[model samples]
Target: MKATHNPPTDVQVTPADLLRMAALYLRRHGWTQGTYYASDAPADNPTPPACVVGAIGIACAGHKVEHFADLDTDDRHTYLDAIAVLVDYLDDHYPIHLFDDDGLCIDDHTSPYSWNDDPLCTADKVIAALEGAAKEWDRLHTQGGEQ
Candidate 1:
């Protein structure tokens, strides 16, 4: 998916490191649209489910999410730790992350929202968003944009 708005030559848009990481990790692992993980006990999940925001959480966090299910008993703390890390990234211009689709009442920060999205969100759209976001970040940085 291309950028919806391309600014003038003097302007640039820098995406975050997490975007690139999410893309790569999702490509290597797998993506889930509607849930934080594909399964409640995701350790044995063959695909190792990861939604857009979850991907960002797992990618940068030193804590292994393979055992993330076990921490569900303390879900608040689990998410809190992840949120703490996300806060650091938020201090910068992480161009695109998870955004809620007001119309659908679901969170889909990918570009698939630009299209019909009738069949349902797929791994392909997720990957496209990650790669596209990464490219956009690189392009903006090359043009003298700050990360």
Candidate 2:
């Protein structure tokens, strides 16, 4: 039998990058379109509820909505650490499905909206979602996927 090679298991990604990816995913899937806030505005004003849900959904799947408060921390240094914990949680749980266009369920692995080859919504899932969104944006604007 020929030897089989396995890819590395550990994924290294920053929480901010993950958030950016989530934002891109949300925009691509019609969650943040036409929703704008001033650059200096507070988080609550600019960050949509769906984005929060998506972040929580990805970080803590199947968790009750009320539990979000428990996850909040006062430690300034641990802010990104909190996000890292959530990203780690996504390694095992199905990511929160944010796309709801045409009543299509994109989160379901069996649904036509399911784009990734794998079922779990890990880092690859986020990346895939971002890539799909970029493609859709490109198709719409004819920007040739620049920037």
Q: In order, what lDDT does every prediction score?
A: 0.52, 0.39
CA shift of 44, model 1, Å: 7.1
Off by over 4 Å in 1: 1-15, 40-47, 64-119, 145-147
lDDT of 2 by residue, 111-134 (tens): 212312234433345444444433
TM-score of each: 0.47, 0.26
For candidate 2, give the lDDT of residue 40: 43
Tens digits of per-residue lDDT, candidate 1, 1-147, equal 468977568532124455666667778877765555666645755446677666755654533454444444544354444343334333232323344556443432322222213245567766665565565545555667655
TM-score of 1: 0.47
lDDT of 1 at 52: 62
- State the lDDT at 34 in candidate 1: 54
